[model samples]
Target: MHSILESVKESPGFTTGLRLSDDDLVLVKNAISEHLANHLARIEPDKVPLLQTTALDMYHTIAGQLPHDKLLTRQSRILAQTAVDAIRTTSLFRQLESQLGAFEISDEENVGRESISIRLVRPGFDTDVGSLHADDWFWKLYDFPVPTGKRRVKIWIAICCEQGKSGLILCPNSHKRDWDYSVIERAGMSKPLLSPDENPDKQIFQSKPGDAVVFNYDLLHGGMVTRGERTRVSMEFTMLIPEDVYQH
Candidate 1:
């Protein structure tokens, strides 16, 4: 059977309006719901504080890896290589790489290899805000050179509780330029750009469970605060391909 990613590549706007089929969406939602329930059930109320503290530390570390100030916690891997492996084998992710013509690498050790970082964000553990700046740690850590003619792509998977909370908003086509490191460094210098009116091409992805949104790395994008009672959970990662990869 054809994979979802393969199917998406055959259609238009695969990068923009990519969504899961009804059956697939239901499967994703159930998986996410079960995962959360299991984790929550296993945690003791007394240990919750410790878990929150550890999660915060992990969030800061991951955020530092990006060129932004803050990113919503979504999921994590025991090792970086594990995350890389999942991205490589996942049909949805492969389609993304193919659509963007991203660089292919054998493993995480490969300099040009694409990678995905997993994080988990839970309610009460961290506050949800409409906007947050991304850090430039990935460029420095991964040795991804500055953006010239082309840029990398970042995909965020809304794994659980996708009721519009924690959705992303982006300035359309901004990835065609250089990375905006200054925006992250000066995160609170001025009010962070939150709403979509700031740019007409701005697109907000209010994904359903299991839905994923991919955007150019250089694109100006940030997280949206959740107002509902349920926690907003998702996984985010970036795809780094050489400039020549996308040249048609």
Candidate 2:
């Protein structure tokens, strides 16, 4: 058996773990649900009784917000703080934090729940499924410089992902080699097209609440549309070992 980080290092750049207990997951999930419910109720107090669908509808309401909205940004920060507290209670997270030194959570654009990436994947809807792509590739394309001795990783926690729901797909061992993404077709900064020959082994993880998938941000990865009738929900956040950590 390999350690989680080792497995991720050897593979397409990701690993999933049920680090949080059932109770822990419930606490976090309830926090999110309550937060959304409160927001909805505050907005329309008279309609609070009518809005019974808290999970999918509440998620969509938050996800549909403009990223720059103060409410959205503040809620994202609150949710991130909630996630950090939940993850810290896990032994696995402590182990990684010890070994990795310190990780700074990213609060920048498209990095939080407000970006609609923390979505309710609906079946047969291209609206929900993100195209196959590497996030860091787009960052690089925009001239984001990643210095030596500093690395960033993204962790996505499943709040309610189930089997056959069309979860995340990643190309195995693709991160081991730095592909010439410039050679791939691209219309803009969003999705990068992969050549047929450039394809690698594809992998997907069936996740449940409290399960988390950690991956290199540079890895080829994206979500698939939900195939099951039940909606899938998840939240994502990134952590980077800042350059100062290497100086010590």
Identify the candidate with maximal lDDT: 2
Supply candidate 2's per-residue lDDT for 182. 47
* Per-residue lDDT over 138-179 for candidate 1, one digit per residue giving the tens place of the 0 to 100 score: 455445465455434456776555465556665555544444
Candidate 2 C-alpha lDDT tens digits along 62-181: 343422133233243345445456555665466567756656665446444322225556555565666667777665555655545566677777767666466778777677776644
Candidate 2: which stretches are off by over 4 Å? 38-92, 98-101, 110-117, 141-149, 178-197, 242-248
lDDT of each: 0.45, 0.59
TM-score of 2: 0.69
* True-vs-predicted CA distance for residue 54, candidate 1, Å: 17
* TM-score of each model, paired residue for residue: 0.52, 0.69
Q: What value does the lDDT take at residue 244 in candidate 1?
A: 54
TM-score of 1: 0.52
